[model samples]
Target chain A: MARSSNGESVFSRVVRILEAFGPERPVLGVAELSRRTGLSLATTSRLVSELVEHGWLERGPDRRLTVGMRLWEVASRASPALGLREAAMPVLEDVHAVVGHHTQLSVLEGREVLFVERLSAPGAVINVTRVAGRLPVNASSSGLVLLAHAPAAVQEEVLAGPLESYTPHTPTGPGKLRALLAEVRRTGVAVCPGFIDERATGVAVPIRLDGRVVAAVSVIVPNDGGAHAQIPLLQAAARGIARAMRPGQE
Target chain B: MARSSNGESVFSRVVRILEAFGPERPVLGVAELSRRTGLSLATTSRLVSELVEHGWLERGPDRRLTVGMRLWEVASRASPALGLREAAMPVLEDVHAVVGHHTQLSVLEGREVLFVERLSAPGAVINVTRVAGRLPVNASSSGLVLLAHAPAAVQEEVLAGPLESYTPHTPTGPGKLRALLAEVRRTGVAVCPGFIDERATGVAVPIRLDGRVVAAVSVIVPNDGGAHAQIPLLQAAARGIARAMRPGQE
Candidate 1:
């Protein structure tokens, strides 16, 4: 492996370059890439050239760099998340058909919930969560379900403090969050009205594999009084996803 | 970028490591990684450690290496394919619901067709295509549709030679393939019966944006002489996907 004069490895620099692109900024100029990655113009240019040569980054007709399709293929084909998403898709489609809103599958990633799949309709309720997006563990229903089933160490760390509130109804206090988590575990579901958006209610349930919670399946629907009515459907869908994800099951 | 002793950059080696994992083999031991990547054990070990540290690769409980969630997130969130998949998903769902078979969205990558999204029912006909999977340009309906609209240079290259046949009915001869491509262009659809599998028929239509073919939306159903009936539905769905993908639409 090669290292720069600043002691950063080439792999590290490449990671920074790749991370610079996101849902909000899918393409960037070389100068913007250099600024975003905090690398010198020459180094950024050289790295970008190498990346483009390997098809990990693409230079469009306008010469702006975007994450390449080859990179997406390589990352996605063998991703551990792919298996989970595959298992959840059918169930999610069913749920989305019934709910006619936003149905999502998410997993615990570090201290946040990373959404791996989401199905939305044309006139679906407002949903801030997009595929591959993340939200604080204490700010969404899926997060609460995952957090409730998370390891003790993870729960303690999240409960330590700094729980950012997205809406006035979001549970930010450690004591209230702890109670909410307990309720989630006891009830086997998390239903939060106005957790992230005032007009939406999030309902989620744990998806277990081999008796260990691996992910959460949730739906974002209008914050009407009918939110709880979808709980059974979500739980059933979660169970179906778990069954489909089990080993040796096609 | 740093170069190894043999002048190979770290980025190139990392690409090899990532590419070594695929749908058939998603997990590998360190020794297997060294063997698959053709990198020395010491180099592979050090690189794997660095990759694990950055969460590009994860070490499972059994010490096997798999592509990490962070890598998938970074590669997916800004992927150019993500926008296409998002636009095609709802239409694909509709097609899948009506067809009750395998509905897919694919794009041309070099001389191959890469499936980016697919929806399948449990009892559907046998279809080999998977999400993020690839097939030769002349071996599938989607490939033929994309190849029909591909640049003339690419078409000539593919028609030049080495057209691998998946089944006896697959178009292998240059003259036949050229005629088929012409038919696809003229009809605005490709119907391949027994192309990839004897029991399945593939029907595809081009999805265009800015008056240029961008992708192929297809469905695989039983090869029961009813494949052509799906042409209109697929064309409508393709048009809907293109409209959804247009800039500033939603």
Candidate 2:
């Protein structure tokens, strides 16, 4: 890759510019983008124009830049998770219908739990997880299940302390979390009350493919002693998803 | 925008490389990518390596390339359609439950109908539409509805001919399509039985925001004498989604 005089590759600069947009700020002007990306205004303007012309970015009526539908189309159609999400959708819908709250599918990515798909009712329990959103691998039930199956290096890195708590019930200490992980690995499920929010409980089960855990199926419901009852349903859904995602099944 | 010795911008080259991966071929090796993108093997290798480092592409165990989850994450999170899709989910779910087949949400993009989201049951009906897939504007019910509300230039362009036919029931002539577009605009719905497949019927209605058509919500069901009955339910769902997508509701 060719680099500029400042030793930055065009690819890296472009990534920085794209990263400036998020769910909170979906549209921005070139000036705002330059400020956010720490790039000079001239470079930002030229790069934005090129991106717009290529359909990876769009210029709105007000001239603000937004991520384009074309980019979304390409990313979504070629996504590695598309097959997994497609296979999991029906099962997740069934789980959501039965559990009557937030049902989610997530995978461990870069020491965090990235939600690939989520189904929620209008008045379901409070859930901070969104599709394509990330939660720390040590704070949520899905994260706990994934952490339980992660490599020893990742486990030790997360267990080396400094795990932030979302609520009083969230496990922040290394010793308690180690015990919880052992229980999850043994029981094939992780249940935590008010781990993410004080008003909700999260239950998750590992989804295995070819005898290896690839994802987690989870549901969030009211923290009212109902966590254990939802486990069987989640486990069943996880099993169904695993079958659907098996090699040659997709 | 510095260009290579051949005068092609790096951004355009990158776009071509990304576009080489699609639904039919989601993974490719460097040699195959070089052939597909018309870029030299060395250039393709350098670009692929840069993209892999940025998490825009991934190398499989067998050394084939695939779209990365991080790219999907960024595009899905920052997508302009996210707000509309989020607001339309519940309505789509309700329609899916009632319709028990394929419920799709589509938008017009560059003379093609792009399906943004789709919901399907396990054994509902034989449908060809997939999420993030595209269909010509003259071949699908959703396409007709969108084309009816599209600009006059786009209408003329489609009407100029070369309308591909998927089934005998599809309108191939300019005269019949003009009539169909008028009927769609007048009735606020497009019903085409056996348009795409002999076994399925397509029923669609336009979803409007600020008095302008923004998308089409449609359902595909078994091609029987029951398409008209679904129009009312589909129209109601479209109205609900329109209401939900209005400013401040999302």
Candidate 3:
């Protein structure tokens, strides 16, 4: 019931301010935050000061501000994704060690795939996915696997395409994508050669918990014939994670 | 500033509500939340509803409330500790593989040690650390390493001790802890045997960024002679993480 002058709740304005920060831009000035949130200067200043006082945001010696460690602690300790990420980590490490490339775990959130965790070595192939980054639900192999298992309405919405293309190999046509989704559901895996980037290949498999598709586990390697060898590895890892999540099953 | 009837800012009250959730207690009913936050029932109900609407909190099917995935995503994407954790993860994985136990990275926050990341194999030691969990400044090896290098004021405050001991090996006396602090600073590592739990030993070394001690890398193994051999491995991993943090360093 507490509304700001613009008829929005205080909680809504606070979220807008927090959303202005990202992996690419971790620190910002008060004026920039105000401009991004479309909030008045006085309101933004007061909010930022209070946030800093409670360790939800931190101030630098240069007077710029960044999200605080306490906020991360509070969010991470109780995140719904924490159990999945923890269960998948050792298996992901095994896959990374044997396969020697980029490995990741993601879940379908809204209309995009939100990456929950990723592992890569110093000399691995290029990967654009950060831990909390998001990509279009039809652009990456992990996204495709998730989209294949999405609810009927979500599937139909994507099928009514304005599908964005990332590279030459990306499937932009709704018909082709629909056929690909059917194949993924049939085969229980997704493989895309140079879909997101021309120089790499992506392979992913569904991770099921309680007989429901919950996540996608994937790896990125060079766009060579070697990708086929990794599908079995990915499938095994997904099964292992699912078993870890549901310990009493099987 | 929007102040509640109690003269505290609403932002502060919101943070208090969030801080009520922890690793041990992730979900709670609204009445419990009201009691934990010491806010009136009406205020807590209004705030919780607004937070749930904004996806910062979730109302479970059973009507309990938990932290939401959107909050985790927003906090994780911009956390200051993300860079350090990412840099240390590979090294931590290597250490865990070699040590066959629990490996972790922690930083000094306020007067306590806050673990940012942890890796544990199934049926490892009986360690008590978790990612995003905090421990007293004098209670664990990681905490000791961080406390040894902490600011003078913090060191003095902790040394003026009401130190709570978890086991007989925990150094509760100020004089002995002062000597241990000097030893850690001299040798650049802390080896605490049975300090936290009786069955495990903790070993830690400092991680430096830009020539300043910024974090601690640690491992927990059975409280036996085998843990001594792991010292070199832990020291090497700490050095590797420090180098990764400063890319141009040797």
Top-scoring candidate (TM-score): 1
**For residues B92-188, could you state the per-residue lDDT of candidate 3 as single tens digits?**
9889888889999999998899999999988899988888888887989999999999989999999896898999989989999999999999998
- Write candidate 3's Cα lDDT for A82-200 as tens digits: 87888888899899999999999999877789999999887887787888889887779999999999998998888786888888788988889999999999999999888899888
lDDT of each: 0.93, 0.90, 0.88
In model 3, which residue pairs have backbone atoms overlapping below 3 Å? none
Write down the RMSD of candidate 1 (Cα, Å).
1.0
Fraction of the real A/B interface contacts present in each candidate?
A: 0.83, 0.69, 0.72
Please write out the lDDT profile of model 2 over residues B78-189, one tens digit for every residue. 8866667888888998899888999999999888899988999988888888888899888899999999999999999989958889999999899999999999999999
lDDT digits (tens) for residues A117-155 of candidate 2 = 888888898999988889988889999999999999999
CAPRI quality of model 2: medium
Poorest lDDT segment (10 consecutive residues) of candidate 3 chain B: B241-250
Ranking by TM-score: 1, 2, 3
In candidate 1, which residue ranges exceed 4 Å CA deviation? Answer: none
Candidate 2 Cα errors over 4 Å, as ranges: A247-250
> In terms of DockQ, which candidate is strongest?
1
TM-score of chain A of each: 0.98, 0.96, 0.96
- Residue range A162-231, candidate 1, lDDT tens digits: 9988899999999999999999999999999999999999999999998999999999999997899999
DockQ of each: 0.86, 0.78, 0.74
